[model samples]
Target: MPDAPTGVSRALREAPPDRVVEAADRAIRSVLGASGTVVFVADYRINGLWPVLDSRQPDAAAHALQGPLQRCFSSQQPVRAAATDGSCQLYLPLSVWGERLGVLMVEMPEEPPESVVRRATDIAGEVALALHAADRETDRYRRARRQERLSMAAELQWELLPGRSVSHGSFQLAGQLEPAYTVGGDHFDWSLDDGRLTVTVLNGDGIGLTAALLTAVTVNAMRNARRSGGGLVEQAELASDTVYYQHRGHRHVATVLLELDCATGRAQAVDAGSPHLLRLRGSTVSRVPLEQQLPLGMFAETRYALQEFDLDPGDRLFVVSDGVWGADPSGRETYGERAMARAMRATRLQPPPEAVGTVMRELQAFHADADLRDDAVVVCLDWQGPDGRAD
Candidate 1:
């Protein structure tokens, strides 16, 4: 029989934050009676996985298990393979909610039964939860996730984000930023309260650290208002006033504030002139038009109007900053005029998480793989009805 779950939980709780992975390995080995185990975490780019090995082990090649590991991570499923010595290698996705952390590989003397596989899956989940919580207390996991050091500006923007993706009963939402290593100005945030989901996309004015600081202030102001029981208008007003006072009409943040009713699929929005909103339903894709208002901080006492719209089941909504829509390489036609719609059509069947990445890749290709001229952000949201069915 497998060891009790509390053994793993207790071990993780007692371990120092930086050493949680080591503690998790020992606890998992005891529970599964496995020969060995290794934890591989996804990098910042989500392009590859890197192993966190013990001091005694020789350095392992980062991409050695990329194919199998990626298959398991993308599918959110367990994969079992036969080893040369007749042992079994089981790869399990380590994810919490919908956010994928990495993969857990266990080598067993023999192929485990279904019951053991199920237990292993649960254990992998526990490990992921521990790592997620440990992120705040230590940089161990964060260091492992990076392929290269991030710029000071990118660091601030990244830390300000809520997460890459989130899943709820009524919808699945995911967002990604481009020029990940040196990103500036562009950022996205969201919060869920009661049955309401509020999402904000900001394209701050300026570049580098200046842009990052501008976005940071606006995001925190909005958060402060929302957390204090304020509604959408109040959130926008507070953020706008905060930015105006600091920049004095010199720098502004283009923003889109959206609030959705999960049960009814009703949405209210405020568009402050930057991110472009597109709607995809069945086989068609079109822009969601909103009255463009002066960007936040452009002037003092600028009032924002709330526009309402309804989302049907099976609808996919995408919000992208100017870096994507306005991408013009060598004075060519802008990406939004044509390329973006085609890209959206191509990703019709993809989930929001994958869709956001695909769209970003398309934007990069449009620039011939050159560094983005501006910071870019892409947010994809799929609304399933209250029944959890997508039409």
Candidate 2:
């Protein structure tokens, strides 16, 4: 029989975040021996992992744990390896469903048995789920996942976006923004209503505090329109007019608005000065043609024309910000559409989250300096049709 979800997390459910993590460590010790336990939580952006429990040495600098922790996370499997002190360490990926969370580690003085490892894995999953639930009540997990302090604008911007990822009956969507601590005005939002899904991506011009405000204004306006039963065209115009007039035409926001009917795979969009949409279908890569228009906050009485397309089962669509492809400030190179096309051809079969991660890595390789002047954002949509095929 399968191991029961461990009761170790039950007591921690109502406790503070730190106490919850401590309880998890204690549970690991109970199952796998009194091994020194450290829970490594994924940073908000999933770029890296950090030790969360207080018992972990302050100067631990356990950089070596990254590799095994990552493998455990991506593979959703238990990892057993030798620590620097020749002792055994067990790394269990902490996740529920396909939502990849983080990793849990326990250091044992000696190797453990299969049953011990199996129990520890089960306990870790339960703990991870509890932490996620507790997050709805406290800022402990949220604050801990942050790599650095966020500016006031960045904080508001974070609140404007949805939980980092989401899924529906037959479709999945995921998004990411880089330089999270200082992201200027990059944002993405999605909602599933009945058989229709609405998504919006925006990159407010400029950086720093003002840019963040522009993004907020744009998103809230769109949200207002969405809530009012507005169609794609109305949603775009309402957001544009609201920002353009409210900001006295002084600020603007580039955006991509989409309305997809999950039942028929029919899609419509307005490309308001953002990057062209890339559609990946079985081994081929192509850009959905778009007639770009002036960004929001620059023109009133502007009506955004809808571009119609269809999503085949198994198709993954990606919308990006100029930060991901525009020419570098140095003018020495550009991560252009061709680069994106090439990458899509290589990764068309992967899931939305992985594809987004790969594109970010490729952009880093393109710049080579690891310095991104603007916030980098990518939103991916995977649509599966009535037949349950994503073709």
Candidate 3:
């Protein structure tokens, strides 16, 4: 049999995009002496894992997230268990950076040695990278993850995201949108360049496709500015101008734009509207107050001011949209008033990737598990500073 890495790489390179999973399965079986291999992809809502390109598993069936699979994915580690036939079943997390893709299951004839386990883990990483690359050319992976069709607005919003999570030496960041399949306007984005990180949270005006289109234009405008070596002020100004010209102040996007110096922990921000920033330092949770400016596109030639702040090495920040803070189901109290602070404290022990999801779930529970009245977004960031000491 060929070496695991070489075999997997060759298989992925040779396979058609839609058949990437099948190619990886064949390579893994040949390299690891496995009887069977199945790649399970986490669904869009992340509530279940569905087997992809596996003949034995029905396409409509999803493995309820629990037991070994859940443990492996959550911990980003591999789990081993005894199979019914006195063989071994190994579950390895398939993730890239901090994005949780799913799990890889390998059924071996006997218990795997530590060496085999390590090799399998590496192979799982390769498969994940392959899947991410293949995603650009095929819809198979996307189809496998969706439980149902997405609304037009949700489809546009989702395609605009960079990714759900990213990890770097100086920081870890993650963001999520609620009412995943139907979310219309709330969005978050980030980019890291030259020891600086730029993050933005946008809550577009209006609803449905109209709101989505507005957000898309604003986000792309900001991206164009940032890519051209523009700072936070430039990004905000360009996006504001683009929106104003398009909507003529008839619509606008409430947003927060922040830039962090990874080495010094110094930060600058532009609070254009509804998105709120909260800081968690040690045990206390407090809002990071900024001079609020008009929402983007509120008027022509609206100038924005830059506000400054400092992030300690151990600090955690949460950026939330109005849909989150203003959520008052059935005329109950809003989530931001008290529940949000408590939720932030509860998730202090988790990393940003997990923390974002936990906070979103708490929001759902706050609404008695009903669909949110409006689109909501949450973004969590942990600054490690230059020395990378923060956990």
Candidate 4:
């Protein structure tokens, strides 16, 4: 028989967020022999403090009424208090970049050493990352349930996108999708085939289940064409026909297909009613032109233009669904390409994930944290992949 685990260890393992917070406090106390610990998660309102974990409330949730944590968030700093029991209370701000996540307070029998403070900061950072991940997970859950009748189109769209993040050789890629519904009509994908990175970002016109269905068909047709050994431009034509005939209507869709040869540093792209591609070189920003033609679903007869480019080291590619550029923050006020360019320039040196974080921060700042009503998708590609033979 396996040895029974300690009751204390089991309790800690089964702890909720507050319990986890308290556990963190206990870890800090053990390392520094502190008296108590208090964790405050900043409320969304940015007003006051709410306890996340605390030893003072053994039976209660330890959460403040969204008041105190708001204060901590507004101050963008931590507040320390010393109780009358001769215990030293230290408040530390938990933030990533400039985003104030929350505050943590630990009470000790006596003043803690500088080492304790350093250790606390590290703990706070980890807590901040975990909190963000949790929040994002919650957001996804809420999004999935926002609309009744979970559309299969939405489910299929999610499955067809890239697998989380791709990190290999000299390339780093990250993508995100936001839908106005359980399924919207925006999709982005990339894969390594024959030593080349083939990328596709498409936005189907209209909304709801119909748009999603159209997008699903478009992606499949495009994939089939590519697998059939057709070139990028040829694949676009084949995919366009497939979508048009599949839908069998005057209804049309807009799409973009890009094929990147990682080994040769050469790329070919075709934009069908999609926005101009944002290309980055060092700090310079340029656009890959959208040639003459209608969106994928908009035309029965269409001529797709092929755009080719030779990428240099450290080049970056920023693509988005129409939802992003089309999303008006406060109605009639659009988040334009210029705004994206500025954000991209600000975090050019960071990886795709960090760069995306910077971009999201800038977007929020631009709107003063106002929510973008429409679905938004953004993908950042860094072509710093291996310096292998340029075939």
Best by lDDT: 3
Q: Residue by residue across 78-121, what tens digits does model 4's lDDT show?
A: 44455677666677766663345567776778665666566655
lDDT of each: 0.88, 0.77, 0.91, 0.62
TM-score of each: 0.96, 0.83, 0.96, 0.59
Give the Å error, residue 177, model 3: 0.7
Report the error of model 4 at residue 264, Å.
2.3
Candidate 1: which pairs clash? none
Which regions of candidate 2 are displaced past 4 Å? 1-3, 27-37, 55-57, 60-66, 77-90, 96-98, 106-125, 136-139, 386-391
Instruction: Give the clashing pairs for model 2.
Output: 244-297, 313-390, 313-391, 314-390, 314-391
lDDT of 1: 0.88
Q: Residue-wise lDDT of candidate 3 within 279-312, one digit each (tens)? A: 9998899999899999999899989999999999
What tens digits encode model 1's per-residue C-alpha lDDT throughout 1-391? 5564678888988999888888988887888788888889887777778887654565645754356777787778999988788899899998887787889988899989999999888888888899889999988778777778999999999999999988899999999988989999999999988989999999999999999999999999999999999988888889999999988999999999999999999999999885999999997898887888889998898888899899999999999999999999879899999999998988888878779988999999999999899999999999899877988
> For every model in order, what is the number of clashing pairs?
0, 5, 0, 18
Model 3 spans with C-alpha error above 4 angstroms: 54-58
Q: How are the candidates ranked when ordered by lDDT, highest leading?
A: 3, 1, 2, 4
